[model samples]
Target: MNAQTFGPMSGEPVGPAFYLADEEHHADGGGTMLGFWIYLMSDCLIFAVLFAIYGVLGSNYAGGPSPRDLFELPLVAVNTAMLLLSSITCGFAMLAMEEGRVRRTQGWLAATALFGAAFLAIELHEFSTLIAHGATPQRSAFLSSFFTLVGTHGLHVTVGLVWMATLMAQVGRHGLIQANKRRLMCLSMFWHFLDVIWVGVFTFVYLLGMLR
Candidate 1:
């Protein structure tokens, strides 16, 4: 037998299967997940600092544009609905991916993106209206804390939209690969985290501001 026909010990050249890309792909996936988790932790730390700052500065009204005067409950209600719906749709996207349904995943992702976009639109409108009414962040300590807390969350949502777009592109290019699924999982966590933070903002900033 030729050397190509078999290994030195087993008399076989091993299975006819060995691809560098496949191996590298798995390694890349693992590294990507680890790096993403580290990034998430760092993000948590940043949010924690922002939250602490908000806690300290939240009550300073500076006699201008208090939350009670500036916050429109009806508009915020719509914004809340948009974000909550997006989270739900994002969850559906994950479910579709888990079932290996690529088209359904894409549909859910599209829906989630639309809802997220709506949330951003409404928030921008709210900010514009407030600024037009002379309730800009520069107007008061209350407005400053309010903007820092809510604007940070809005910025995160904007980033999430970008991330969602990238994920949709990957899904289009690669289908529902394991790596894509893992990334979707991380994004899901991030989306849900933002939802929770919004809850805190609604309760502490909006609702409580009205009481005071």
Candidate 2:
């Protein structure tokens, strides 16, 4: 409502100092955060279902290769490291942004993008190697589930990389304005969520496969 309208409702005179923008902006921030969190929760449900499916179908190899024959711990470990490092760099970017150090924030964001790219490259290589070894998704039920779970995660990473690049450009152009800072926070949450998911995959899928 306009100031005059509000003033009449309050039975007081309107002041020149009143601003609706401040209230709107504050509400906008809270709304954006809430919307994104709801989105993340939905994504959590998607992954939960995927994990459940994989758990049920994981051992149905149809006499084909199991995780032991397919998984390379050394390469998987390196891929995990790449993603974990990206998380660190992303955190550093947030800190820099908090301090209003635009150049440092941009540098750290760039570092994060590099690590994210490295993670994708390593994942792609692993997929290619598995396919080359005749462990295609259609080879067995186990292979199908593995590819679906891991490939879905890879797809998320690819999108994250794209978002990271876009956000970097935005920061470069806008210099960490409030909008850019908000976007950065959302990206950080997303990237860290992926990191958490990968940890689950590593332990449940990779490590447990070794034991089984």
In order, candidate lDDTs are 0.84, 0.90
State each model's C-alpha RMSD to the native.
Answer: 5.8, 3.6
Please write out the lDDT profile of model 1 over residues 1-212, one tens digit for every residue: 32233467977565333344445766667667677779878978877787778778877877775667778898898899999999999999999999999999989999999999999999999888998999888887777767887898999999999999999999999999977888898899889988988887777777877787
Number of colliding residue pairs in model 1: 3
Model 2, range 1-212, lDDT digits (tens) per residue?
Answer: 44542365666755433455556756568768878999999989988988888899999999989999989999999999999999999999999999999999989989999998999999999999999999999998888988999899999999998998898888889888888898899999999999999999999899999889
Off by over 4 Å in 1: 1-31
Q: Candidate 2: give the clashing pairs.
A: none
Q: What is the lDDT of residue 185 in candidate 1?
A: 89
Poorest stretch of ten by lDDT in candidate 2: 13-22
